[model samples]
Structures are given as C-alpha cells and as structure tokens.
Target: MTKRELIDNIARDGLVERLVANVCHRRHRSLPDLVQMVYEVLLNYDEEKLMRIHRRGAINFFIVRIIENLYFSRTSPYYRQIRRFAQHSDILKDE
Candidate 1:
C-alpha cells in the first residue's frame, strides 16, 4: 500500500492513538514523541516486507511486534548506553 493510504487507514482507525495510550499508561515518557517514533518506523517500512505482511494478513500482529520491540529495546542496556552517549555529547556541546 502507498504511504498516504497507510497513514489514512491508521488515522481513521485511530491505531496510533491506541498504541500510544497502551504504552503511556505503563511507561510515562513523551507520548507525542513516542507516537511519532512509531509512525516514523512505519513510514520507513520496506515495501517487500509490507507486501509480505499484507499477504499474510497479519498486519496487527506485525504492528504490535514492532511496538513491543521498540519498548523492550528502550529498556535495554544498549539503548541506555546510546542514550547516555547522546546526552553526554549534548552536554559537551552546551559547554
């Protein structure tokens, strides 16, 4: 499907809001940024993979997996280290 169609369907069905609400209730972070991140991931989807998902009719499963993976990655040590590195760089830049 095209980007416009994917976005339209997501918006019309409130998929992003539902996903964000599900996450925010448990993880108190930037809701808008998280939601944007999800969409950004979706926007960068590989067409072949998307087509395979469409063929399998497991779109919801795919989306939930993506979100769960993103959440788990955020809680991982590697993610924390990367975040800290970014923050350290930002602090250095400020000085």
Candidate 2:
C-alpha cells in the first residue's frame, strides 16, 4: 500500500489520536512532536511490518512499536536528560 493510504488507514482507525496521547503521557507531558514522530514512523514501515500491523488491528499496534523503538533509539543527550529528569521528578515535585 501507498504511504498516503497507510496514513489514512491509521487516522481512520483512530490510532493517531491514541498514539499522540500516549506519547504525550509517556514522554513527560510532551505532545508537540508526537504527530511528527507518528508520521515519520508510519512512513518508514516496511512491507512485512506494515502487513503485520495491518492484520493485527490497523496502526495502533504499529504506533506502540514505534514509540518503543523511539524510546530505545535515544542517542541524543536531550532524551537522556528527559529520562533522567523523569526519573527524579517525584522528589523535585515537592520543591
């Protein structure tokens, strides 16, 4: 299927909203980049992977996988800092 078709399928299945909200929640209240991330992930889906996600239940599961991959692929010091901050947020919250 075409990239446009995949994106349309994802949006129509309500996965986009779910993924964006999930990313926002998990990424320490960050939502601004969630849509762009999803777009990138969906556009890069390989044929086998795309078929798997499509068969399972559209793009919802695929979005989950993308988020997982992104979290693990954090080579940037920025994401590392966010993770560190997130880990220590409870104590900082009372300050």
Candidate 3:
C-alpha cells in the first residue's frame, strides 16, 4: 500500500485513536492531539518503507511504538505541546 492507502486504512479503522486511548489512558484529554501527532509522524515516513513494514505485519507495532514514545517521552513533541502544559491535578483527575 502507498502512504495514502495506509493512512486511509488506519483512519478508516480508527487505529490511531484506539492506540492512543490504550497507551495514554491517563491522558484521555489529549486523545485528539495525540492521534493527530501520530498521523503527522507517520506522514513523514517514506511511503515504500511504510508499505514494507505493513507487509511484514509490523504496522500495528510500529504505530503503537509511535504512540508510546510520543506520550511517554519528555523530549517528544507530544510532551512539549500537550503534556508539559497539563497540571498535576488534571492528570490525577484523568486517572
């Protein structure tokens, strides 16, 4: 599959949303932002490489890693944009 096709498949299946929900359960309010960030990161990859990863049955793993890193890594864009601004009480509230 091409980049567009793979992205369409992910979107059609709501893979990003599900992955974000599962991986960022404590940060539920960031769901939409995380999903969008995942897509942005995926969009930067080479299409042929993405297709190869998909063909190897590692696409889900790949996406999940992206979600995990984005939500958990302090240096990640997700942290810089969303997580950093979240107050401690807000995080506790989500939990």
Candidate 4:
C-alpha cells in the first residue's frame, strides 16, 4: 500500500483514537500531539521495510507495532525523554 493508503487504513481502523486514549489514560495526555507523532512515524517509515511488511500480509499489525515502539520504547532516549516530560507534567498538575 502507498503511504497515504497506509495512513488512511490506520485512521479508518480507529487505531489512532485507541492509541491516544490508551496513552492519555496512562500518563501521556497530549492527544493531538500523539496523533501528530503517529503520523510523523508513518510518514518517515522506510520504504523497503514497508514493502517487506506488505508482502507479509499483516500491515496493520506492523503499523501498530511501529507506533507502539515509538510511544513506549524503553531504550529510545527520545521516547524516554517524552515519557519523562509527560510524567513531570502530570506531577505538576497534581500539585
């Protein structure tokens, strides 16, 4: 599938809303930002990897995995920072 098709499929499947709701309840509360981040991840996905994945017949699963990895990756310093920031903001709100 093309990139646009991939994004459309994801959104049409309600994965974006589900992801945002999940993360929001779990401490990452920025719904719009998370949606944008998901889109960014999709837009920047490697074409070769996508082709290989498309051949495998479970593209939505792969897409969800990619987004979940970016959102909650323990080893990714950038995602760690985002999680930390979200936690700190939550703490502030509780103050």
Candidate 5:
C-alpha cells in the first residue's frame, strides 16, 4: 500500500489512538498530543518500510514501542515538548 493509504488505514482503525490510550492510561490529558506525535513519527517512515511492517504483523508492536518511548523516555521530543511542561504545570498547581 502507499504511505497515504497505510496512514489512512491506521487512523481509520484508531490504532494509534488506542495504543496511546493504553500507554498513557491515567494520563488522559496527554492522549491527543501523544497520538498526534505518534502519527508524526510514523509519517517519517517510507511506504515500503511501513508495508513491510504490516506484512510482518509487527505494526502494533512497532507503534506500541513508539508510544512507550515517546511517553517514558526523558530525552524524547514528547518529554521535552509536552511531558516536561505538564510536569511543571502540575508542580505549580500543587504549590
């Protein structure tokens, strides 16, 4: 499938959203941003690679890893861009 087609399939199936929800769990506020970020990352991959992943039935595992890394890795862009700010806001609210 083409890149756009693969992306459409994934989005239409709500795979990214479901994986983000599963990864974020109680962090509901981060769901939308995380899902968007995951899509952005996925878009960086070429159509051939995405198709290979789909053929191997590794799409879910690959996306789950992306979500986990984006959410939990301190050096990830998501951490720097969203989670860090979120943590600071929570701290300020508590203070």
Candidate 6:
C-alpha cells in the first residue's frame, strides 16, 4: 500500500485509536500527521528500536515525541538544519 493508505490504516486500527488521540491531545496535532511521523521515524530507526519504545500495543506514545521533535521542537535539526538530532536536546527550564 501507499504511504497514505498505510497512515489511514494506522489511524483506523482500533488498538491504537485512543493512544493516537492522546498523542494528538498532548502535541496539539492531527492524527494522520502523527501517523506520518511514525512513518518517517520508522524509516530511519530500526524496527527493534521502534518496538522497544512503542511496543506492539502502544505505538502512539512514541509517535507523539517523534512528531514533536520532527516538526515542532525548535532545538533539533527537526526544526533547523543547524543542529544535529543527536547532539541537541536543549529543552529545559520548566521543571
């Protein structure tokens, strides 16, 4: 299937439905967009890493951070090409 079709499938899968909703609530983004994030990260990271973080039953948790870091976070290359994804994690000051 195409990426779009896979994303749609991810969104519709009942097991992930609420977890996807929770991620959307936390990140203030859309569901398919969140699924897209998972798709991208899945490309770069290994399935073992993803499964380790997301697990078979709860991938949405990982999807939230993936999307947040990839799109909204300002510190990493996710936001600008200036910083590397590994070396920059300057999110701080609230705690």
Clashes (backbone N, CA, C under 3 Å), per candidate, total 0, 0, 0, 0, 0, 0
**What is candidate 1's lDDT per residue for 1-95, written digit by digit as tens?**
77558667887898876876775464443455555667777778986777678668887767767666655576744346444455577799999
Better of 1 and 3 by TM-score: 3
List the candidate numbers ranked by TM-score, top first: 5, 3, 1, 4, 2, 6
Instruction: Say which candidate scores most in TM-score.
Output: 5
Model 2: weakest 10-residue lDDT segment is: 76-85
- Give me candidate 1's TM-score against the actual structure: 0.63
Best by lDDT: 5
Error of 1 at 20 (Å): 3.0
Ranking by lDDT: 5, 3, 4, 1, 2, 6
Off by over 4 Å in 5: none
Against the unseen true structure, what C-alpha lDDT does each candidate score? Answer: 0.66, 0.63, 0.87, 0.68, 0.88, 0.52
**Model 2 lDDT tens row, 29-67:** 544344556667677668677767776775566677666
Candidate 3: tens digits of C-alpha lDDT, residues 8-61: 989999988887887777555767998999999999988888989999999999
> What residue runs in model 6 are displaced by over 4 Å at the alpha carbon?
1-38, 54-56, 81-95
**Candidate 3 lowest-lDDT run of ten:** 22-31
lDDT of 4 by residue, 1-95 (tens): 67678678877888776766664564555556667777777778887777677778776577567556766787644366577677777799999
Error of 4 at 19 (Å): 4.2
Task: List, residue by residue over 1-95, the lDDT tens digit for candidate 6.
Answer: 44344445665774344555554464433455545545666566665655555445455656656665655567644446422322344344333
Q: What is the lDDT of candidate 2?
A: 0.63
TM-score for all models, in order of appearance: 0.63, 0.55, 0.87, 0.62, 0.91, 0.40
* Residue 85 displacement in candidate 1 (angstroms): 12
Candidate 1 weakest ten by summed lDDT: 76-85
Among residues 3 or more apart in sequence or in different chains, the pairs in candidate 3 whose N, CA or C atoms overlap within 3 Å are: none
lDDT of 1: 0.66
Error of 4 at 32 (Å): 2.9
